[model samples]
Target: MKKIIAFAGSNSSKSINYELVKYTVSLVDDFDIQLLNMANMPFPLFSEDDERKYGYKNSLVELKEDFDEADGVILSVNEHNGNPSAYFKNLIDWISRLERKFLEDKYVFLMGTSAGKRGALGAISVTENMLPRFGAKVENVFSLPEFNMNFSAKTNTITNSNMEKEHRKQLDDFLGKLIKK
Candidate 1:
């Protein structure tokens, strides 16, 4: 079975982006899905001094291995004042140090969500553009706006019919690529 890694680029335990990742991957079948939480994989803020002093951690090697082995990625990023969260940015910085193209040849289904109406669009736009620089080809993008009104934690799915339709459509397209020759 093909393997895909799903993660939300947020440090919060109760991230809306994480909820979106779960909802998106729940609809997929017959594939190996590794759901990761950045909160569980915490690292200190990236700094050149730290890298020079400590070298690379063994954990970083294992993390790189995960990226190398995956066929695709499911990433939902959090917005912090119209920018990617510091935790995610720091993670990327560390990962990039291991290899410039750590995500090379991987197809990514990118998403973001927020409590307000903009739906983390600003963060998504920047991430979508920057990910390619690290060699992730973003195949699809979704932004779930007004998380309180649109998603239900009890149901573990998108509550809004129109948004759910679009979300599923995008998810299906990304899944097709993984299952396709």
Candidate 2:
């Protein structure tokens, strides 16, 4: 079976992006999906000094192996100060140091969400722009805004009908690409 890697960039215990990823992966039926929670996998605040002092981490090598084995990735990033959260950025920094262009042409569905009206669009934008540099195709993108109002925690799904349609469409489109190859 084809494998899909799904993860939220946030490490918060109550991350809405994680909820979004759970709901998204539940919609898939054909592939073997692996859901990774960054919250449980702790990393040091990345710095040049740390890499120089400690060298590569075993966890990052394992992470790169997962990326290499997967056919696609579903990634939802959390926003902080109109950018991808520093925690997620730190993960990228450490992983990229392990190997350049580590994503290696995987099809990626980039997503984000927030309590505010902009849906964490800024973070989504930055991630989308940069993933290609890491060899991610970034095949689709979605942002859910006013997460509390648009998403239902009780039901674990999107509550707004219009947003639901677009959300499914994006998933379908990304799936189509994965299936075609």
Relative to the true structure, how large is the alpha-carbon lDDT of every model? 0.91, 0.93
- 12-126: candidate 1 lDDT, tens digit per residue: 9889899889888898899899998777888888999999999888877788899999999999999999999999898899999999999998989999999999999999999
In the range 1-181, model 2's lDDT, one tens digit per residue, is: 8899999999999999999999999999989999999999888998899889998778788998998899999999999999999999999988888877888878999899999999999999999998888899997999999999999999999999999999999999999998986
- At residue 66, give the lDDT of candidate 1: 94
Clashing pairs in 2: none
Give model 1 RMSD, 1 decimal.
0.9
Q: Number of clashes in every candidate structure? A: 0, 0
How close is each model in CA RMSD to the real structure? Answer: 0.9, 0.9
Output the TM-score of candidate 1: 0.97
Global lDDT of model 2 = 0.93
